[model samples]
Structures are given as C-alpha cells and as structure tokens.
Target: MSARRLTLLVAGAFCLGACSSLNPFSSSNTKIPALKPLTAVAKTAEVWRGRVGSAGRFVFQPAVFGDAVFAAAADGTVVKLQAGRNVWKSSVDMPISGGVGSNGRLVVVGSPKGDVLALDAESGKMKWRVSVNAEILAAPVVSDGMVVVRSADSRLFGLDPADGKRRWVYQRALPALSLRSSAGVVQEGNAVFAGFPGGKLVAVNAINGSLMWEGAVAVPRGATELERIADITSLPVLGSRAACAVAYQGRIACFDLANGSTLWARDMSSSRGLDQDGRHVFVTDEKGSVHALDLSTGSSAWKQDQLAGRGAGRPRVVREYVVVGDVEGYIHVLRKDDGSLVGRLRAESSPILADIQLSGGDVVVQTQDGSVYALGVQ
Candidate 1:
C-alpha cells in the first residue's frame, strides 16, 4: 500500500476509536446534555445565511476580510460573500479539509491530500496551488507576505503568497501516538507560532522559518498513551507580551512572547482552544465547562458549567460578551465579566464544530451541515 493510503487508514482507525471514546452520543458513561430552552436576554438578528458545502466531521471556520467573508466547505467549494450576498464562488476541485485564510487580496486553503490552494479573494480565481505532502486539518495563516501551514504529521511550511512556492519548511519528530488534531498556526509581526503534540510551542520567523524560541505549555505525564496525551490542540492565544496555550490532559500556560519564558501556568485541561481579552483568558475544558482566568495571574475568575458535556467549541470574545457554539448548533453568549449566560441563538440543526469568528460587530458561524450565518448581537 502507498504511504498516503496507509496514513489515511491509520487516520480512519483513530477517528473510529476517538468517536467511540469521545463522541457524546455513544452509550458511554458521559452524557451530553439536552440544550435547555434559552430565555433570550440580548437581541440577536441574523444578517445572512448561506451554504458553502458540508464539513462532514471536519472543522472549517469562515474568514472575514475587510467587508467580505471567505468560506470553504469539505467538498472544495469556496465562496466569497459581501453584505450577505454571494460575490463569487469557486472550487479547488479536490476535497478541502482546511482553510479560508485571506488577506483581502489572496485567499488560501488546504486539503487532506496536502494541497495548498491560493485564490484571488475578489474574483475567486485560482492563483496557484502547491502540495505540503501531509494532511492539513487546520486553517492556513497568511501574514507578512508569507502563507504558513501546519500539517498533521508535525511539519510547518512557509510558502510564498504570490505563487504558492515553498519558502521554508520545518519538521519535528512525532510521538508514537498522538492526537490527530493540531493547534494550528498564528502569526504576529515577523514571528509565527504553532503548538505541537508533546505540549511544546515553537516560534519561528515567518519569512525564513528559522526558530525563534520553543517553550513547553504542558508536559506529558502518565503510563498510557491516552493518559500521556498532552497535545496542544488549540491555537495559541496571543496577548500583548505573552501567548497562552492549552493542552489536553495537561496544563494551560502563558509564555513570554520575546524569550519563550513561562510567565504563568496552572493545572488545566482542555481539548479545545482559548480566547483572551485585555483582562482575562477564557477556556473550554475537556468536560465542556468554560472557565475565565486572570490573564496576568492564571487564577480562576469564574467557571460556567451549564454547557458541560455539550461539546462546546472554542470561545471568541466580542465587545462585552464571549461567544461559543456547541455540537447541537446553538450559539451561547456569555457575559465576559462573570461568565453568565446572557443570550443564545440557533443557527442550524447540525453540529457546529468550527471556531466562531467575530467579524466587525457580527459573529460568523459555520455549521457541520455546511451553512454559514452572520449574526449581530445587540
């Protein structure tokens, strides 16, 4: 069998096992809570709703440029929407497993087959395409005239934004067993950051892909693979001087952005990502509870367990509220000051696995059924 085929088979087996062990619908000891009817407190209006394509079991978040939004579906359909209307629609002609990263002029996406595609953001015309030779499950980030992508096999590639040519590639050895998910990549100035399976976070030059610093967000500990799983599956949240990251079965830590020093860390576990504002950090724990911690001290501010076992997505902080979605298609709005549930809206009947995007004064959500909705809260 070919190497690609073998990788796919292994991924399939891992997915099956993960579903049996982690799926809230299974007859396991854990029970996913039925969503309670929300008593609306804040006013929410849907700006526009449209379909891109089905995400199936994959995660795909829409990207918001200046006045437009770019979204890609699992079937390779990419759409650009302006003022809630379709501006242009195109396809990569291959299964797009990750993407919708844009910088107004150029939009980039990735496929499970390792194909990285760049398109004109305004015209939806294909500009260039290249292969990274590994599965890209996270959205590609474009910044500093470079496009950064992370593959499932722990390789990071920096490509030229103009022609999709390889600029630099960084590879790290993988553990014998690790989670299939990734922390994705984030760019700040000339530095690009990514989290690895061993709970390590690395910063590199976006232009040359040279290592800047590497720090451990969580340290693996235990006897079994499941017990020792400390993968940083969420995108690292950057603050003014520090970047915070979470690890499954490991601690959430804040590291100094300049020197990779551990600023603060606390015993916390999460499968999803985190969000931070000026004062506090918000995280969704493994059991589906969301906690607010002091950004400077890593002390717990509040914990909201109302959505426990509901398969919550990552948190996105808007002006005064933090927004999160669930596997059941409900968008929960919580007051950032105290972690209280303030408002809830249902986008679709399907599960929402992707991170919610806060665009301008609106929130953009993409459901598993391939529907994208822009909503405004008042």
Candidate 2:
C-alpha cells in the first residue's frame, strides 16, 4: 500500500471509536470502592511497544490513528508505528513537540523557532508549513477543516487545514498568561468552543470567528481568592451538552456550550487533566490525587490520592480504571468506583507528556522517548 493511503487508513479506520466520543458520563458503571494500598511489587509489563531505537526524549506524546501512532521528538524526528512495527520515519528541523492532529496527519511545532508544519499521515512527507507569531508549546486541535493553534505569545490562530493558510488570529485581551496548556477548540455544529488565558471560555461562529458567547470559568470568587490563584492549565473537555475547564487554584467547573453559562464549579487545586464517563467527571490535581464529581450536580462522589510523589498524578479515566501517569513514567490503573489499583504499566522511563488512549480494548501510551506502546488484555 502507498504510505499516504496507509496513513489515511490508519487515521480514519482504527479503533478510535472510544476516542471520538469522550463522554464518560454516559458510559456504563460498575463501581468498586477504593482498595487498600498495595505493598506488593506491582506486577506490570508492556505487551508490545515500538521505538526508533534512538536516544532522544519526545517532548510531545504520540497521537494515535487507529492502531498506528505518531510522535515527534526534541531531535526533530517523526516516527510512525503500527501494532509493534516501525512503519515509517521522517525528520524536520528542531521539531520539539506537537503530534498528529485529529485527521491523523503529523503536526509539528518547530522549537526555538516559530514554525508549524503538517506532514502526510502515512509517508511522513511535508504537506504544508506556516510561521506563527511566537513559539508554540501546546498542541493544536483540528475540526471541520480548521486548525486552531495556541502560541506562547498567548494568541490563538485558526488556519485552513487544506493548505496551512491563516484564517483568523485572536490575541488575548489581558496579559499573556503563560499558557502551559494547549489551546482547545471543539466544534459541536456551528459554534467553535475555545478557552482563553484569563479563564474565559468563549464560543465563536466557525465560519467568521464572530463571537457567539463568552463566560469566565475557574476564576477566583472574589478579591480574597484572587491573591492565591493563577491560570487554567487543564484543557477544556467537551461532553454531550456541556464543556469543562479545571483550574490551578483548585476548581473544577463546567459550562454550558450553547450560551457559555456556568453550569457548575468547585474548588479542586493545581488541576492537571480531566475526563468524564458521561455520568461522572474525573479530575486529577498536581498533588497526585483524583476526584470523581457528579457531572450534573457538581457533588463529590469520591476522592483519593492514588499516587503521591513529585509530578505523580494526572488522572485519565478509560473504560473501568482511573489511569494516572507519574513524573517517573509509571502508569497506574486504579479502579474507578472507589479507587483501587487494578494494574500498573511502566510505559516509559522518563516523564510522559502524552495522555493515555483507551481504545479497542487496549491502553495506549506514547512515552517521552518518542516510543509508542500498547497494552491489551489477551
């Protein structure tokens, strides 16, 4: 098969049904209360993993297209893997982070330089490249032929996915909040939903970048709290009818997508990442703790510190487990009901910047070494 066609097939055909619909609130529930801590040396193993066998760290995690995985490393190399086989490899100058976008094409953010490039999904051939206003640290999101990117200068750009042409750019109205979190954009139908530096979540018409609605999320309640808090680092997670933004000052909040109204909010701290099972929303904090909150009422159903260490937690809920990857590269899969450690898988030896993918009866991870691994129950 031609490499381009293979890449396209992998992007569109693989077991991405689990990723396409991220509504955790609607998933089936089988609760298991938290279990006792494990003193036993966790029996963990990697089922099948692939890498370039090169010595370089991958700052960006791999993006999955069906069974295929794509990632770029600090050394400016891009590798594609299917199952456990290294299918193809390519390189660009100083490609620090960024991965394949929604369409399975590799998207690269040129580091120490301000450039963004798109490559053919299968062949690793350059398709297009564009220069932005500043360095890009976060990943880009593609929806409806539009590529929305966030740059270090606290600006958002909407580009035509066909040719990397700039469509519109929106600079933050307030001081450029050091945007460690990537800019998130989701298109439900006609509205483009996105979050900004000042904790404001806004929706713009997809065609013209016209403002539809805007609401501040995760903001300090008053002056008393303002002295203690900072920006929203967690990416905004979209659900069936709502979207959520968790903040650093310990707040878990959700907003209505249609009008940007506050649906629910709670103080949660140093929030890192979020996932939902369609009924319950799961959030992880910097302190290596996870909390399950009622999606509709904003009530806490359960909370536990499943991992405790420096850079130990950023909970990811997939299927039946609360999956967390620590700074040391050990991924712990805990029972979601109460918080029991179901399995532990060491996917990498260095810190992981990529999120976990639960798809097609497998747990997929792309490590900092630019390696992609899949663990499944046989």
Candidate 3:
C-alpha cells in the first residue's frame, strides 16, 4: 500500500505545508498559534541510532518482538535492535516495504520481486521464503500459526508460520486503486476480517480462505481537490468492537466484526488512517486537521487545525498523548481529548511517517531515510 496522508481542513490561510516536510505539526506555511511550552510529562532522550544502506526512499515500519525492534530498510535489509542497541543488520537482494509479523517465528513480506521471509527472531537468519507475484505493502498479520498478508493484486495469502508454506489464498475483485488499501486481518473467533479497495469489507474463514461474508463500504464523493490525492492508503485499524477505516477521498466507516455490516460512517474526504483510544477514533485530513470522534456514534468530539499549513502522518497513541509525524520530520505530541499540542520530538528532517510504536515506555521510530531511532524520558 502507498503512504496515507492525514486528514486536514484547509479553509484557513496557514494551510500550505508540503507533502514531503518532516514535522507532523509543522507551522512552516501558516502562522501557528503560540503553543504553550510543553511540560515534561514525557522526556524524550535518544537511546540509540543506526543507519541502513544508501539512505533509501522508504522506511518500513518497525515491529517489536520482546526486547528487540525489527525494521526493514528500503535496500531490502532487515535489522534487529535489542533494547535500543543494534543486534544485527542483514541485507536481502530485493527492496521490501511491508512490516513484520510472527507465528511461531518471525515473518516479514518483501516487494514485487521479493519473497515472504520467515526468520528466527533471536538470530537474524532466514528460515524459509515464499515467492509471490506482486508487491507487498501492508504488514503481514499473524494469527493461529499463519502469516496473513495482502498483496497489491488484491489477494490475501495465508502461510504456515513454521515453514513459510501456503495455507490458503483468496482473490477478490479489486479496483485499480485497491492496491493502496493495506489488508488488515482481525481474528474474531473462527472468522478473519479484512478490508479491501473498491469499497469492500470481507470476512473469511481463518482455517481456509473461504468467504464468509462480503459487503461494500461507502466511498467518498466530494470536491475534486479531495479526489485528486484521495484513496485508502492505510490498513484498517481494528477497534475493540468495530473495524475502522479512513480513506483519502472516501468516507470513514466502522464495520461490525461479526458480520461485514456498517455500524457508523463519517465523511472524511481527505482523511487517510484511523487510530483509536478504546472509546474514540482519531484521524487527520490532507489540509492538516485532526479529529477525534466517538467510536460508537462516529460523532466528532473535537477537531483541531494546529498542524495547519500541511498534513501527513499516522497518529499513534502513546500514553496520554497522540503522537504523529509530519512532512517536516518532527513528531508532534497532542493531548488526546481536545487536540492540544503537548510536546514535539525533533528527530529527523526528511522524515516519512512509516509507523511508530512504543515498547518499554520508549518511542521507536523508523524514518524514510532508512534510519531507526529510539527516544524516551531522560
């Protein structure tokens, strides 16, 4: 899947931020409000830093397994960091983008010319690799001893985690832009729930790729400005009760986990990804606006344009703050309730917001330049 842009409302004069800037909350274009100096709720101190080959174009999101951080570089290298320390960095022949997964062992997906590799988590050694016909953009979801991955060809493949053997594969009717919607697999009892492009929500049997239920979701039809760069470029965020999905030019909707039915839908014409805090779902638009909505009702609780002037990043909830990276390589920490800027982590300059995760109370971030850094309180 391609990178998903944040949802923003661009009515104000400050909205001119570039799509490539690093700060998730950059005020480069718009005169930003005087932010109250951030109190030390969380102090970010750099733990360790490491570089990958040639400073590639994309940084695959990092996945944490126990005390180690697993990251895939643009040069098709997978590096392991143990507790903020570099363990090993292994290079493959092809460039890869998908995130990491594990069944009994660690598994990761590569590119159009790459294979799905199952490696030993403790040692960075490859166990087996399954060749695929398409590129893998989304992270492989692991469940029930199987590694589940969605390919650019609108196909879902299930492989044995132990040996990288094919368990089952399901092909769906995908639109031209369906390759951008990363497959999100959620296990509820015996059924596996995954989202698709061309506005589809499907439920498949976990044991086999048999279809359980399929339904069409509400796609966005808005102004031409919204449609130009609009598409569901992120994986569906699975909430406790519902699976939430945001589209660049489509509507944000929650589907029932039991059956592929729409529970609540919100029109986010320029939105991309959805992050939840158990009760509320957080999202952003292309114009640099962030919104908090009740997960159950899909009603807006709060909306803020603090990241005005430009918008791009996936908002990850860390503790009481919602952390999102911008086009300007800075990570903005916002209060979860009303969208107030709490703190900012100035990490990289040309940062691509891949995926951010917290392990052991420290923030682990992967940059587009194939660099990984760990930050935490002093």
The most accurate candidate by lDDT is 1
Overall local distance difference test of candidate 1? 0.85
lDDT of 2 by residue, 212-297 (tens): 88777756444532333345655667788778877665467788866778888877665467888788888876565778888898
Candidate 3 lDDT over 71-145, as tens digits, reads: 776667777877657777776667776766553357475665547776676677887788777767667777655
lDDT per residue for candidate 1 within 1-378, as digits (tens), equals: 986566556644654566442333334555668867777777778899888888865788899888788999988899998877899999889999888788888999999889999999879999999999988888899874899988878789999998989999988876656677735788999999898888998999998999999998888899975567688888898988889999887999988989999989998888778999989999999878999999989999999999987888899898998888887788898989998888988867798877888789899998888899998987
After superposition, candidate 3 runs with Cα above 4 Å error: 1-42, 53-55, 176-191, 220-230
Ranking by TM-score: 1, 3, 2
TM-score of every candidate:
0.94, 0.80, 0.82
User: In model 1, what is the error at residue 121, expressed in angstroms?
Assistant: 0.8
Best by TM-score: 1
Off by over 4 Å in 2: 1-45, 52-58, 105-110, 176-179, 182-191, 220-229
Model 1 stretches with alpha carbons more than 4 Å out: 1-15, 18-31
C-alpha-based local distance difference test score of model 3: 0.65
